[model samples]
Target chain A: MSPVSFFKCLADDTRLHCVLLLQHKGELCVCDLVDAIGESQPKVSRHLAQLRECGILLTRREGQWMYYRLNPQLPAWAAAVIGQAAEGNSVYLKPALVRLGKSESQASCCD
Target chain B: MSPVSFFKCLADDTRLHCVLLLQHKGELCVCDLVDAIGESQPKVSRHLAQLRECGILLTRREGQWMYYRLNPQLPAWAAAVIGQAAEGNSVYLKPALVRLGKSESQASCCD
Candidate 1:
């Protein structure tokens, strides 16, 4: 996909958060994202759908749960963008990561 | 600036082209961008203004011309992201660069 479409996928607050969380955690289920982002399940799901539609994210199904991760096939530059976004704005993302970590510490739904 | 804002700024066709050109050419003036992207001067200027407002680009004024380049202060990852975008999508951007090159080959207004 073109870089414009790739970046357009990441322009939203919810979508950007989902991508950042996936990048940070490697993989997460919808519930994991919901807990981490403190947004409703449907809201999180909608953003995930947008990311998926743009081909930036890939999904896998495990029984009743859906797991999400950054598309491994994403061009190097796209990953670099996401990586830099995560790094340059850690202060904004730390809380979400911390929350996801805590949720995983308690119990990961993906397991 | 936050990653969302940064990406939002680039999500536009015009703005993204301006940035890709700036990244490819190192620096370009408003007229150079207008010629390279084949857009009107006002539209190019507007996108350049948006990019500047978001801090992704820095400008220098020389006489009647203002030159623009990627913000040097951009985090390494951000630069890498732009670099990768330019690299991964050269096919999409080649024509614009060629046009810009041709324009320069003839005569550079910035000179």
Candidate 2:
């Protein structure tokens, strides 16, 4: 992604939440994200489109569900923004992180 | 901000760049961001507005210029996403971060 585009992607809290949902889990469909984040399906889909356009995320389709994950080849500039973001303060960021981890474990064990 | 909002903010790449621009410098106006990110004036303004709404950023107006910074009290959920974002791969995130640091140093020494 271009420099400005990265900022655009990260500007939305919902998008950031969706990314967090995808982080450990690898991929998720719009419905899955809706359940994970508890939002309307359209909202989740819109944010997913934003994430894909920004290039921070990638997608796949199986049957009818589209899944997304963190793009592995992080550019240095985008990487820097993310580097510091993790360290900054936020009340919701931590708890959501905990839940995301929990979900991963549950899915892994079930699989 | 709530979990969904944070992800929404982060969904846009341009917004991510602006936040990174603000991360080190403490604050920035729409114009400064326009210059820093090399986008149009109104575009920067709109993005700034988005950041402000998401609560990942805080803003101030001095004379005609409105400035913004990373909210110091980032929710844990947001912080976790950022933490992983930095570690995850993005091409733009790193170089933009470098430019941001360079600009800060230049300004500090000048001051």
Candidate 3:
């Protein structure tokens, strides 16, 4: 049930879609999440909260908006999950993440 | 934070330890998890349940026992997480899982 929850948390296309957006992208504002995931504010906010509560993401309040980023506490294996999912997806996600100082040109796999 | 939740689900040493045992081992009973992770039966059961709830593991009922195996529904990325963590540890995990029709030689990385 525990591990299933982990996968279930990730199983959602919207949530995974949101995660791939924020991952390695540094801090992203709620506006960006809404834009990228194309979901309503309430929907995105709820998903973000779920991820935050589980410790997969961290947030920073800047001015009137909160910025989200991948938390450093995640195990190294978590990176592998991101890499595997975003392997071919970097073409779209990398460009979007360029503003965040991350370049996902290719998924870096262990050699 | 959605991604963070995924990491937190896997954040526990006990759960990760149990996951490694089931990843490619076909199916395992709770007893195997207890033996491999050296945790109490309740602890192992909870962890296994968590994994199942997350859609990472699947369960089946035998004559008197329930067998757990990695869920095929997991995204390919999940396998990478397991591979990354078990890269160097397969020496131990694989031998223990041979009874489950699995072999641990070396981690296979994408080239």
The best candidate in terms of DockQ: 1
Where model 2 places Cα greater than 4 Å from the true spot, the runs are A1-111, B83-91, B94-111
Residue-wise C-alpha lDDT for candidate 3, range B36-94, written one tens digit per residue: 56678898898889878877788998876788987776655556666665653565565
> How many clashing residue pairs are found in candidate 1?
0
RMSD in order of candidates: 1.8, 7.3, 11.1
Chain B fold agreement for model 1, TM-score: 0.94
Clashes of each: 0, 72, 24
**Residue B61 C-alpha lDDT in model 3:** 88
Across A10-84, the per-residue lDDT of candidate 1 in tens digits comes to 888899899988888898899999999999999999989988988899999999999999999988878888887
Q: Report the lDDT tens digits of candidate 2 across residue range A26-49.
A: 676666566556677888788888
lDDT of each: 0.87, 0.65, 0.65
CA lDDT of A95 in candidate 3? 43
Across B1-111, the per-residue lDDT of candidate 2 in tens digits comes to: 544456567656677677755664667767556756767878878878887776788887777667688787876546555555554544556666565556666753223
Q: After superposition, how far is residue B28 of candidate 2 from its true place, in Å?
A: 1.7
Better of 1 and 3 by DockQ: 1
TM-score of chain B of 2: 0.72
DockQ of each: 0.70, 0.22, 0.12
What are the per-residue Cα lDDT tens digits for candidate 3 across A2-37? 433455556565677667876645667777777655
Q: What is the fnat score of candidate 3?
A: 0.15
Off by over 4 Å in 3: A91-111, B1-78, B85-111
